[model samples]
Target: MKINNLKNLFKNNFVKNIFFVSSGTAIAQIIGTITYPIITRYYTPDEFGVFVTYSSIIAILSIISSLKYEFAIPIAESEEKAVNIVFLCVGILIIYSSIIFLALLLYSNEIFSLLGNEHLNQYWYLIPIGVSFIGIYSLFMYWSFRKKEYLAISKTTISQSFFGNISKIGFGFLNMGAFGLIFGDILGKSAGITVLSKSFINNKCFSKANLSEIIEQSKRYIKFPIYSAPSKLLNTLGVQLPVIFITLLYGSSVAGFFGLSHTIVSIPMSLIGTSVGNVFYGEAASIGRKNPKKIKELSNNLLKKLIAIGIIPLITLILFGPILFKFVFGSNWYQAGIYAQIIAFLVFFRFMFTPITNIFSVFERQKEELYLDSFRLVLVLIAFGISKYVNLDSFWAIGLYSLAMCIVYFVTYIYAQKILNDEIKKI
Candidate 1:
């Protein structure tokens, strides 16, 4: 009887949807984990650092690649309207990519010098290409969510993982260096987007989409381009700041160590939190539209589950982070394990908050989210600035940075909860 009841609970559409996405995420993460040890062995820390540095740049700029209009797709009132939004976003993305391409051509050398890495200059041209793929994939992903095509979304993730790793590992064997990792990332994104976009692309549904329709959709969702775009840019910079600062202040080696540590520790968040966030965004938007009173209950349940799921892994990392890193990734990554230990608390809260954080979007609270994200950016910058001026050791600097982020995440969570509570009560 108990087993039957549990099965029935899992049958709930929201729960089942989460399972579909998370199951694919789990498989993808597992594949990455299995292949990572080998990839690490083949690629040096400096090479990984170079790749990540470029990735950080792409991440910062990619925020506006689509003007973040992709975010509005899920909540748009109708599929036809959502299709127009996608076209508008893609139009912006093309113009954005062309602008970036020209900028890189003009200032690539100066930017490379500012980053304190000459090796990255060679990878400059790939930035626009990679960001284009990322932007397009994001559009397809949000469209998939809007349509509730969870299964297709899940399969694409797994396929992306499989194909991307194949290329990375294969290139490593060919001794391609950082180029291997960079291209792997791009190819993976291409594969995923191609899979998600087949139906929409084939039907040419947007061929009849007129400039006026695109303009109307753009204006209707202007909040995303204005508020959400800058907010997202700041948020990306905050997350990638550690990489940028570490590379500038210390060197690529330390940056690489930090990157590896962050990547490993974030597996659970990527695998579980991302899946939950996507599903939550869709379900919450639906609830907000039809039944506002249940928002608090949904938020509370999600919070409890996130906390429970995260506690054990975080505790284990705090206790045995270094040993785990050494055992899993090799002794060279021992320092990354230490870094992971310092950041575990922050990751726990971030993991718990990220999925539910979209509630701000569901409620059209982009202004509030923008404020919170800006505050986080300021705090992170201050943290790194103090460490730089004080000439602290890299370890202590990361500790300080980690501490700052943890506090910010906690505050953000509380703010979100209060806002959600107030909104629910009003409804």
Candidate 2:
């Protein structure tokens, strides 16, 4: 009877959305994990380092190409302009990456020297090669979210994963090295875009997204790209700082361990937390605007769910990380167990905090969200610096970093709850 009641309780849109988003990505990540062993067997740490570097550069470029507008698109008032903003972001990314490509061509050696690795210098060519299509897919994704098309969202993710696995294995066998991963990344995104493009672009929603509307919409959130560009750049740098520190202090080998362990451990977050957070953002925004009274209720409900559902993955990682890494990804990845546990405990804090952070967008608390993220930025910097100077192991540094973040999350939740209460009292 109790189990039946619990099932009935999750019948609402929010619960269904969470299930839809999470199940698809969770399955996709599992497939991605399965493919890891295949590639890891063929690639050396140094070769894998190339994959890591190029992937990171592509990630950074995607962010730059995005101009952070995707994050802000939901907040825009005009749906038409929001539609155009998607393409606008795409146009800007292509233009920006093209310029970057030209410059890299002119100063390949100088750029490689800047990265401290000549090998990584050539991968810059892959930037324009794949980023254009991938960038388009990213912007279109925001459009899907803004339109509340969760099922389409789920389908795209599944197709991307399926194609990604096929292309990765096929290309990896061709002796293409890191290019295989790059191809997998680009082709996956391109496939997703192609699948979803017709529905999104042809919808009545975007019909209103003509040039005049684009200008007005662009004007509305120009500050986003401006402040957000460098903010996101710094934030990405902050994320990768540990990897950079690992390389500087310990060399490419340890950095490989760091990257691999980070990836393996971050699975729960990348799969579950991100999937849930994606839906939560759109859901919170919808409720805040239409059903203002439900904000706290939804927020608290999400916190409980995150804790409950999140624990299963955490236990799996803590228990099976070493064995799985050793057998599947080879003995070298055994250290993944230790790092996975540390990262999971850290991600646990993140999982709890994610829904609350989304509430910031709920009540139009963008500034407050920015402030909290800034606080988090500071904590990440301090932790990274200490780890670097004191020469802490990757385990210790990551744990410290996660601990600082957990503290910030709890404090922010307390404060946001209080403010929410005060606002409700006046009602």
Candidate 3:
């Protein structure tokens, strides 16, 4: 009877969406995991450093690509209004992509030089293209979530992962270097866009959203652009700081190891946490507005789920990360395994915190999120600063960085709980 009840609970729409999203993510990640051995064998760590550098640059810039107006799509009160928000986000993204292109044209060389990867200059032109694809995908994804089109989203995720990893391996064998990785990323996104466009972009929805509607919707969610966007940007920089600083301080080889470790850890996050978060965001927003008490209960349930699911994998990584990395990615990547061990705890915190972080949006606490992100940014910078000033080795420096971030993530979880409890009291 208990098992049946649990199975029934998992059949709820929120859980169903999570299941579909995770299933697709699992397939995608499996493909990536299988291909990684071949891809890593074909490409050197130094080359991966260049790829990571290029990716980090775009990752930071892409946060502001739509000024974050895309975040409002699912939260909008009505489908028509949400449709307008999508168009509004797309318009802003176009402008942002153009601005990035011009800036890159003017300073791509200097920027790559500063990041300690001048070799990335040849691929700089791809940044705008990559940004546009990612930005548009984010916007479209929110709209899909609003419509509860989980199957479509799942299909696109699988398509992207399948095509993207395959291309990277193919290009690697061809000796295309970092461009292979970059091109593969771009191609994967293209596949996603093509799938989503066919799935959701129709004349009826597009026609309902006009210039005036777009402008009005943008104003309605202006807080997203003003506060949420910068917070998101800072959060992204914090996440990518190791990639940037490792490259600058310890050189690209160390950065490569760190980047690969991060990529491996992020697979779980992308597959499970991100999928659940998207579904949770949609459901939480709706429930929080009607019966606010349900929000608290739902959050608690999710917290339990995240922690319960994450604990074992995290422990396994901390214990045998080096052995696993060597066995899977060859002896050359053993350093990546070590890096993974140091950061494994932090990844656990991240896995739990990321999905629930959307609770900030549910409670209209974007400002608090901004403050937390700012503090996180300071902590990351201090970690790098202390390492540089004290002449610490790469391993110790990374340890310090991971420790600080783990502390920050714990505080975030506490803060989120408090926010949820307080909101429950008010209701």
Candidate 4:
């Protein structure tokens, strides 16, 4: 009887889908994990700082490149509408990236000076290129999600990780400095586009998308741009702003340490949280319309499971984060481990809340997310302000930041539960 139950569990589609996605992410993260030690040896913290700052800029811009219309792809009512949304996203990406490139070309020095990292002025052109690649990859990845093409998505994840990491190591050997890290990242972002594009061509999705349909769908999903895009931009700001602040206040080496710690701590989030979140988003959207109560049940169960999964990592980091960083990354990165310990609480809560928060988009309750994310960003700024006011070191500033974010994410978890309850009551 137990064996039969186990076999049946394996046959379940949701479990199967998550397995495929998570396996790919697991392999990709493993490759990255193996290469980090080597990469760290070749590049200094200052170089890593520069790379992190450049990445932060790209990440913030990429959030709104399509005005977040790609988010509507999975929950779109029909294949035709979904395909049109993809074209809509790609079109917006081209225009947005072009604008960014032109702006940088004309105002590179002024912008870099404002950012307090004029070192980026030399590579200003790469900003738009990075944003474009990231935007394209995201839109297609969602299309894959809508089609239930988990295996294809998995292959692309592996391809991205393998090629990107290999190139980073190769460039490190050539002593290419921060530019190597930036270019390698751009290469990784581009690697998956070709494979994702095949799905579009094979399905004749390209021919189906027309300007009229694109405009119609854009209006149909206008809320995504109006509410979801800005909300997501603020959320990205909450995540990426610290790097800028650290760079401005403490310098590149400190930002590098912070960046490395963030990278290491976010591994579980990338590996499991994102994989499960993608699958959960697809599944929840399917189930949510028919049974709002089921969404509540599903979210509660996921929260419990996430808490269990996160506790071990949290405890491990608290106890031995610095030691582990010294041992695994290098002795020079000992400070990063200290930062990791400080932020582990935030990462843990983030891992739990992030996957489940798709309930907002699933139900079109983006305004609540916008409001909450606004508050979250404010809290982050307050943390930084307090740290700066008190003249604390980067370590203390990060601690205050983590503590503040933990409170907001916990509130977000509660609020998400309430959103689910409110939906259930409406039924």
Candidate 5:
């Protein structure tokens, strides 16, 4: 009877939506988990380093590719308004990507040379292509979130993983090196576009998006471009800069090890954190105006659940990360496991706090988020700078980085709680 009651509780709409997204993310992660060992064997750490550098650049750029107006879609007032926001995001994405492409063409030599990775010069064109695909996918993703099409989103996740992983293996066999990894990623990102586009084309709401409406919505949500975009960009930079710094300072091989560790640690974030965040954002947006107290309740419940779900895996990694990495990804990757151990606690805090921090956006507190993200970036730079000053090894540098991030995430969690409490007080 107790088990049946628990099952019924899990069947609620919020839980069901999380299940749809998480199950899809789980399948996608499982595919990567199974293939990563093979991938590690096929690509040397140096190659992985180059791939990570390219990916980090793309990730930082993609954060603002649409100037973050797509984020307004889920919280927009009406279907018509949301549709216009999507169109606005698309227009901005095209212009932003084109600008990036032109800039790269004019300065590819200098950019690649500064990064100390001449290998990326030949593949510079793919950066803009990647930004476009990621930006478009994000626009569609938020639209699906608004419509509560979790199943469609899930399907796209699975398709992307399947195609992307298979392509990576194929390209690796061809010995295309980092280009193969980069191209495979591009393929994976593009794979789900057709599936996600169906929601837009089939809905009559899209036709409501006119030039005037787009302009109106753009101004209406002007804070997204003004504040949210920079916040998100800084957040991404805080995450991706380590990879770039490691590549520049310790060399690509060390960066590759760190990248692999970070990837493995981030699986839980991708699998559960993102799923919960999507559902939470959708639900919170709906309830934010009507019943703000419920947002507090929901956030508290999610924090507890995230803590319980994350503790065991993170603890296991901390204790046995090196062993697992060696056994799974081969002996050469043993160092990656050590890096994972150093960052496991950081990932735990991140996994617990990151999903719920969407409340910042939910409450339209983009400036606060921007401030926190700026603090995070400053801390990261200091951590790396201190490491270089002392000539600390990669492990110690990562440890310092991890400590800084843990502090920031904890502060973020407290701030989110304060925001929720303050919202309730206003009533």
Candidate 6:
């Protein structure tokens, strides 16, 4: 009886989207999870580790590659103008990312020397190309959100995961190793881009807003990308910084394990935390103009629900992480499993409060997020330094590293809670 009632409640729009988003993410997760085993069979842990490190760097570098335009798309005036804004942002990104890539090519030798990773030298060739693809793909996803095309949004991701990981499997079978993983990822983006290009051409959003209006509104809007973009990017970097440090201090294999664990943990996060937050952004962005009190009400409820959803999985993982890791991911990724468990636990704090902090964006608090993000960056450096000196293992490094980020989330959540309350009072 209770189970049936719970199911009924989730049928509501708010809950329904969460479930649907998570379901799609689950499908993607399964594809990626299956690929890991084949990848393990073919690549040495060391090789996998190098790829992992490069991937993390790529993830962080992605922030620079994209120039933080995705966040801008949703807040634009209308669907049509949003399309124009996105294309403009993409144009800016192309110019900058191309320059960076060429510079990287010219300075590749110096970079490898400074970074001190011989394996990384091989991956450097892909970085420039990866940046452009990542930037384009990001805009495509954001465009999906701007148009409220959730089904298309979900399908794109599911397809990307399926084809990308499948490519990895074939590559591993052919002894392509980590390069296969990189190629698989690139191919998935390329595939997604083709799909996006077709949809974009047909979509009438391009007819809605003119370039001048977009430029005007960009200057006028509360959620300008200049600040919001870097904050969002830093948030991603803060999470992945551990992999960078571990790669430098210990090696890429440890980096691989860290990346592997972080990727798995991020599944639930992307499915639940990110999905709901994205919806909330769309819902709450205009609440300040209409009814700010409603934003408070929604955020409070979301925090409660997010906490409830996070707790059981975290506790379960903590108790059985080692067993699950060994059983599920092959022997090579026991470390990955353990890291996932720790990260899951750490994520409890993060997931518990992300929704509330996200409300700040509705109120134009990107600067506040930047301040908190700055603190997180410092803590990341400290955590990395300590781990390097004390020689912590990969899983623990992953855990301790994320612990600092949790602090930022909690702080932001508290302030956002207060800000929403004040807005309610004003109303």
lDDT of 3 by residue, 1-427 (tens): 9999989978887888788888888888888889888889988899899888888888999989988888888788888888888878888889989998998899988988988888888887899999999998888887787777888888888998888889999999899998998999888876777656664556467778788888888888888878899999999999887788999998888988988998897787647788888888888876756566776677778889999989988989889999999999999999999999988887888888778778888777889999999999999999999999999999999999999888888888788888877876776
> By how many angstroms RMSD does model 1 differ from the true structure?
1.4
Question: 224-247, model 2: which lDDT tens digit per residue?
Answer: 676666655655655665565556
Candidates in order have lDDT scores of 0.86, 0.71, 0.85, 0.90, 0.90, 0.71
- The residue ranges of model 6 lying beyond 4 angstroms of the native Cα positions read 1-11, 64-66, 194-199, 204-211, 221-223, 286-288, 389-396
TM-score of each: 0.97, 0.88, 0.97, 0.98, 0.98, 0.89
lDDT order, best first, reads 5, 4, 1, 3, 6, 2
CA deviation > 4 Å runs, candidate 5: none
lDDT of 5 by residue, 222-326 (tens): 999889999999999999999989988899999899999998888866467888898899888877655779988888998899989998998899899999999
Best by lDDT: 5
Superposition error at 118 for model 3 (Å): 0.6
How much is 244 displaced in model 4, in angstroms? 0.3
Q: Which pairs in model 5 have colliding backbones?
A: none
lDDT of 3: 0.85
Q: Is 2 or 5 the stronger prediction by lDDT?
A: 5
For model 2, what is the error of residue 284's alpha carbon versus the real structure, in angstroms, after optimal superposition? Answer: 1.9
Q: What's the distance in Å from true for residue 140, model 3?
A: 0.6
lDDT of 4: 0.90
Task: Tell how far residue 195 is off in model 4, in angstroms.
Answer: 1.9
| Pairs that clash in candidate 2 | none
Task: Tell me the lDDT of candidate 6.
Answer: 0.71
